[model samples]
Target: MFTVTPEAQKEVSVFFEGKEVQPIRIFIHGGGCGGPMVAMALDEEKDNDVRFDIGGIPYVVEKDLFEAGKPFEVAFNGMGFAVNSSLQLEAGGGGCSGCSSSGSCGC
Candidate 1:
């Protein structure tokens, strides 16, 4: 299962406060060149999504994308909050073959 770090949760809570709707997190499981990659966004919840609490913030994931071995973590980089993936989607010795651009692997 995925988990949101305390720092990320705090940021999200502050950001969504007083908004009309609760912020929704989306996990898009396809991008880049490898056919299936990872993407995330914040928006209204979708119909086929599952809701869960992480570090007190609400998170949503597509039903199909919710797998048994998910290793997700929510953290803050220098600028803002971000979700990190534990699943290594790299491809090949040098780097990801599907990742055409440097550090552009959409995993």
Candidate 2:
């Protein structure tokens, strides 16, 4: 199941106020040092996707992905949209020698 908090709903509504509304696609976004993260995109629905409606907004996710990340929630984290799910992602490897930052390296 998918849910959108009122705060997030309001933000989304404002974002689409003067534009054509499209279904929000929730999918797995490959992460950097943090590991895989959930993300949102505006896209057309596919045959293999599962759809959910929250506060008049349409959300779509791949069937297999949705099944694996069941019970997802979309909320506003003040800075941006935060998608929460039960799916646990394993962290990526430690920083490489070429990485510039000592903390959270991209390489």
Of the candidates shown, which would achieve the greatest lDDT relative to the real structure? 2
List the pairs of residues colliding in candidate 2: none
How many steric overlaps are in each model, in order? Answer: 0, 0
TM-score of 1: 0.60
- Please provide, for model 2 over 51-80, each residue's C-alpha lDDT reduced to its tens digit, 9 standing for 90 to 100: 998878899999999999989999998899
For residues 4-55, could you state the per-residue lDDT of candidate 1 as single tens digits? Answer: 7667777777777787446466565554455543556676778887778765
Q: Candidate 2's error at 32, in angstroms?
A: 1.5
Q: What lDDT does candidate 2 reach at residue 30?
A: 80
Q: All models: lDDT?
A: 0.64, 0.86
Off by over 4 Å in 2: 95-99, 102-107
